[model samples]
Target chain A: MSGVRVILDQDKCVGSGQCVMTAPEVFDQRDEDGIAVLLTTAPDTGQTDVVREAAALCPALAITVRE
Target chain B: MTSDTVPAFPMARAAGCPFDPPPELHRLQDEAPLSRVRLWDGSTPWLVTRYAEQRSLLADPRLSADVTRPGYPFPAPGRPTGAQKLGFILMDDPEHARLRRMVTAPFAIKRVEALRPAVQKIVDDLIDDLLAGPKPVDLVEAFALPVPSLVICALLGVPYADHDLFQGHSRNLISRSVPADQRGASFRALHDYLDRLLAQKTADPGDDLLSQLVTRVQAGELERSDAAGIGVLLLVAGHETTANMIALGTLALLEHPDQLALLRDGDDPKLVAGAVEELLRYLNITHTGRRRVALDDIEIAGVTIRAGDGLILANDIGNRDPGTFTDPGTLDLTRDARRHVAFGFGVHQCLGQPLARLELQVVYSTLYRRIPTLRRAAALADIPFKHDGAVYGVYELPVTW
Candidate 1:
């Protein structure tokens, strides 16, 4: 199976870090602003589940994960 | 124990255990995850106490936070007249989300993290003042209330010099026992004051949140009334909850010397973060349950909650649910307590949480490290707990080194 691609709208991101907290491997926060940055837009198979969960739980609805 | 009558909601905590929830709340969680509880209005609402039930139900679109909705549980005695014109905290979906999103940027993790140095300076200056002042200082006045109050004032572009005006009125506004007219009067005063500030910011914008909203208003992105509504909400919510948590959390740590010792010596950021989460879970300062009304029939835990049914989600009980947390009552800093619903859940979950967390992190770490000998000046029994208030905390936490 192919990996999932994560897209983050930085402007809308409230920097809750829910995405980074949920899938550390796929997402990391910028040091200066705490906005979400895609560590890996295409997360590998094992990380796909959590990457999706992070997108779903984001309060600002800033993250989008597409196959 | 099948009886036609239900236990009253807002049950009192067990005698002498000031930190824990009412024994009856735990009992209900044990016997039935979902059960009915009578409110002050003599109406019975379903009280959901378990973590799973609370999380799901809070997230359910079938449930609404709109105070105007039929059967919406009004936790406190006051009717909160003209609540529809107030902030979105009491509104549902589109309106709530719209207003909430406008203010999210300021409290975003990065933004709050950036304020860490300013927050640290605030904490440090307050501690210096406390140390130099008379022994047995009231931590609430000296530290807890001032830090968040100043921070929120700065964030909203309000002058800290006007603390006496808003802080006093905020106390009345949130007090569960204050007369309805008094609370309403206080709310109106604060609302009018903020509305005036919003109008001023429109003419002369500063570099604060109010200025940002003013810019938005000028750009035709937001209404002046909505901006003022948000200002009122942020001013109240920003200071009060975090202030209570600071006072209560410190007292909780003081009670548990073992945890305090770790926080005092342990320089691990991860450990400090975990300790904050544990304290948030254990204290659960929002003692009154989160209120809602079911918009549609929803089945959970083998019972169906019908449409128009009032529901009170007891966050204190769920935070202490043994099913979700290990040895939930005991304050274990090492426990994975991040999942606790101390901030409530779903869309209405506290928007100021990021800033609150940052402030707590700085205060807990710095206070213990600077004054290693900090101890209670007065005995725990002598301290007055806010049992009658909407928020759970000590009125005055006297402390000395």
Candidate 2:
């Protein structure tokens, strides 16, 4: 396990889906409004790099990751 | 504040290098990353030239994209600002978020990925028409414009036959040199057209974007005028930006046969996707920098931007910042150019980017391979570039196989 804690601030998310596009395994968008929904709060070791990438790529600065 | 010290905004590109950004922007990036530049109205806004500063400032909540605010730099003297005409995209948060969310589902990554096959079909059908058409056809008119126009029409349920009505007005809307009254008239025309179309969708709805908006309106979730405004924004932005990228990307690729051959002969999907990103980073269709005004006093990079100060986030030069990308001037297709701000950044980052990427990927992957001998029929100097328009692209690309 990566022991990575990911927090998504829905209020701040613009729903651009940069996170979902960057790390699909760890994130997805709500079907109703396209707001991001986390698929997993703690990503595996293999998914850590891409999860961090999703956090960085997010335009709204909505994603926060604690390693 | 002297004219000699402060260079004017929208600086001209080099005479021979139509693909590169204005040379002055490069110098500004090197000497002073954030410096003042005069707009058409004699207002000096801070022009952000470096990539790092652009991304951070664009994402800063203190910088407002709302054009209605005072000191918001207008690209031209009397041109109608986007906030005056377009909805959501030009507004600030809360209100911007409310309107933007109502139509976000259709353009979500999953939703757009599902549209890949359909987008592929659109590209394939257009290429078929191009192959059958006469030699030396204007690719801009024949292929580039129609591909996105057709796809957007199908998505929005706007009849493609009405393209002439919308496209003509769209041209007027984006042109900086167009008279203010003429541009206002174009805005009204498109707004009224979409307004009526929304009414029709209400009477007989379909499984398309406008109908979706109609549903929101009926449920008391959105206003009719705002719905129409969103329609106009999506319709105009959907086609215009992509069409330019298509024609200009083709021109760029043809100019570099080595890069063109890499895309043409290679079948790897990753290579094709990387090529699309590189082209977007290089061409930067939105040539006029992203405009904003500081809502609160902010300090960064050893400078204080007072409230009401205007800013021009020059993404064209920012994309070419050597600090971010290696050998930024060279058009290398294989480089990891994903961080480029060609699409702009922050909450206002392009909503339709997934769709844009899907369309470009399909076209870049399929076009060159299908038409191996696709070469430019016109000389570089003879081709007309879109210097007058807000977007940067060639006006017409004449090509022959």
Candidate 3:
């Protein structure tokens, strides 16, 4: 089993909301600005794939998911 | 390809096929993913055709969106004469980020989600009026245009009474065939109108995005001119893109009876939203490629784009690239089209997408379910498409139930 930690660099976020779209459970965009706000540092195992996908797919690459 | 051999960019779509993208674009995709295409001003920009390459390049920081940059390719002819350079869409990072951040909150997914009930109510009311009205009505004017126009107006605190004034100018602004002077006049008219609206918001702030921006302006967090500029960008983009999608998407469904049946019979929100995505990918309303100037040397798909070289990210073709989407040409509503770049890709991706998506979902699901017998009043050939417009759509979609 692999353990993962997700980190978001707020400054780099372009607010495309791809991360939230990909993993809404683990991420939500701040209403103040569309930047990603991590809802859970370590999401459940079932949602890992989507979290990884969100990190990979973020156009700004602001999201980092380390396994 | 060099400037001498490169053909002119912005090729027109084939006759009788309004929904399909320019066939020449696909040919280039199959041949070379990245090759130079000459623009109107004799500048040869690398036209990226493949999906993966486009996705990667759009996110690359080296490509500059600043129109003032020396080698930047202006998609349209002449400068936006009277319009001030406003909003972050045309800017590069830091500055782009600073300006865009101010307007992002109101359009965030959660914030937009909160407006679903209102959006649904608006859609239902519009459909009710549409149903009560006479048959063989123009969908663009009657339904498609009003829904987004109303939603955006309500959001921006712009008076709905002046829709005709702004809408008229918006049409003139986006039409590619409109003469430069006329377009400039339209731009000036809208700019002045927005500036006036912002002043009103500043005086009597309402519970709207523009009003909130006024607070920011008062606090010195944002510039008054920039706020007005944001208003201009939003006023036009907020409604124009979605309005076209509604009209064109509806026409597309009517043409494809099977697809129409699928959308009509099903009330599932997920299914309807997915169908909207497929339609967006299939009929990319924004036909012109995204223009950018390379800030530094960059190599992609085996071609080296030198510093100051112009690049065109043709997302319309990219959405249909066979490598990414199986049977790219077909409009399969069942396809998982979440990856579609219809809203665009990278940092400069659409800001109003969440609201647009919610509005589209409500409209697509409600329009068909309410009027099961809805059908096209005129043949596809008889309907005039906005071929010479910045955004692709039918000028007037005549339909009857």
**Decreasing TM-score order of the candidates:** 2, 3, 1
RMSD of each: 3.1, 1.3, 1.5
Cα shift from native, residue B22, model 2 (Å): 0.7
The stretch of ten residues in a row with the least summed lDDT in candidate 1 chain B is B77-86
Candidate 2: TM-score?
0.98
What are the runs in model 3 whose C-alpha is more than 4 Å off?
A: B1-4, B81-83
In DockQ, how does model 2 score against the reference complex? Answer: 0.82
Report candidate 3's interface RMSD in Å.
1.4
What does candidate 3's lDDT look like per residue over B132-210, in tens digits? 9998999999989999999999999999899999999989888878887897888778878887988898788899989
Cα lDDT of model 1 by residue, B247-347, tens digit: 99988889898999999998998898888889999999999989999999998999999999999999999999999898999999988787878888777
Clashes of 2: 0
Poorly placed runs, candidate 2 (over 4 Å): B1-4, B79-83
Clash pairs (backbone) in predicted model 3: none
Per-prediction TM-score: 0.92, 0.98, 0.97
lDDT of 2 by residue, B107-128 (tens): 8899999999999998999899
In model 1, the clashing pairs are A33-B110
Give per-residue lDDT, candidate 3, residue B127.
Answer: 88
